[model samples]
Target: MIKAVHGDITKLQGVSYICNAANGIGPMGGGVAAAIRKAGGKEIETEAIKVCKEQNPMPGDLYVTHAGTLPFQGIIHLVTMKQPAGPTSYDVVRTCLHNLVAYCRKQGIDKVALPALGTGVGNLDKAKVAAIFKEVLEPVKDIEFIVADIDQDFIALFA
Candidate 1:
């Protein structure tokens, strides 16, 4: 059931869970995080920040929290901003996604969604982003990987 798809994650229906391209601050903003917050509500952000702050996972770390206004059971927040080297996050994109996926898999989560990290705030290449994901996830068997690209051209490029 783990596969890639092109769709609007905010409007995603009948799904049990999705991942947010959350910043280290753990607040909601534009792009996938914004859409999830807009769909789910502020409760999601509140719960996520609380959980993340409590556990205090280092950069390249990931945590989970209630979806609140979002449609899934929970949201997986990955700390792509605080990676070991620095905030210059281009190198962390794949590691972050891989860690995000691994964190989900460890929890017995088989179905989930994700957005292209590093592309928005991180300013990375589109092809490389897609390739990194494909490389990291192609070997996994159970986790359903859905990529949400709200733009048609963006979706086509990934397609």
Candidate 2:
């Protein structure tokens, strides 16, 4: 089942993973990344850097790391853009959602918490990003997905 809720992703419970809208270079600088890093602790960033060193994921790619001190078991960091210079394309957002679902299935994670990808730091359209999420995720029946965000506009799209 897919649900839209307004709350902090870091505080969400009963989720196996939380999706972080990350840059390709692995810095938790601003927006969701900053919030997650603050709540999940420095280990989250450390693990993410390790993954970046190993995988060097590009835009639209994803990398997973231990959730560190957070409640969830893992953090799935989606590289929403190659850099923070400009907005990401719809295709990049779509690819991130696809990759997230695939990773969840492979890891046997039944529940996930995700923020609005590409909407914050990426400057993509919230409704468009939400629509893409619904397009890609609504078809999958197995995983329990939560689109968690403090932004009313973003949450309203899913609602």
- The best candidate by TM-score is 2
Model 1 lDDT-worst window of ten:
82-91
**lDDT (tens digit, per residue) of candidate 2 on 1-159:** 689999899998888789999887777878888899998788888878878988888988999888777878788998888665456888998998899889889989988999998888677888888889889999999998999998988898876
Per-model TM values vs. the true structure: 0.84, 0.95
Assess the local accuracy of residue 7 in candidate 1 as a C-alpha lDDT between 0 and 100: 73
Q: What lDDT does candidate 1 reach at residue 54?
A: 79
Candidate 2 residue runs with Cα over 4 Å from true position: 84-86
Q: Stretches of candidate 1 above 4 Å error?
A: 1-3, 83-88
Measured by lDDT, the strongest candidate is 2
Expressed as tens digits, the lDDT of each residue in 1-159 for candidate 1 is 334457777677666677766666567766677777777888887886777677776656777778875557887776666432235355577777778677776778776777777666666777777777778877777777777766554455555
Residue 70 error for model 1, in Å? 2.7
The lDDT for every candidate, in the order shown, is: 0.69, 0.86
At residue 123, give the lDDT of candidate 2. 79
For candidate 1, give the lDDT of residue 155: 53
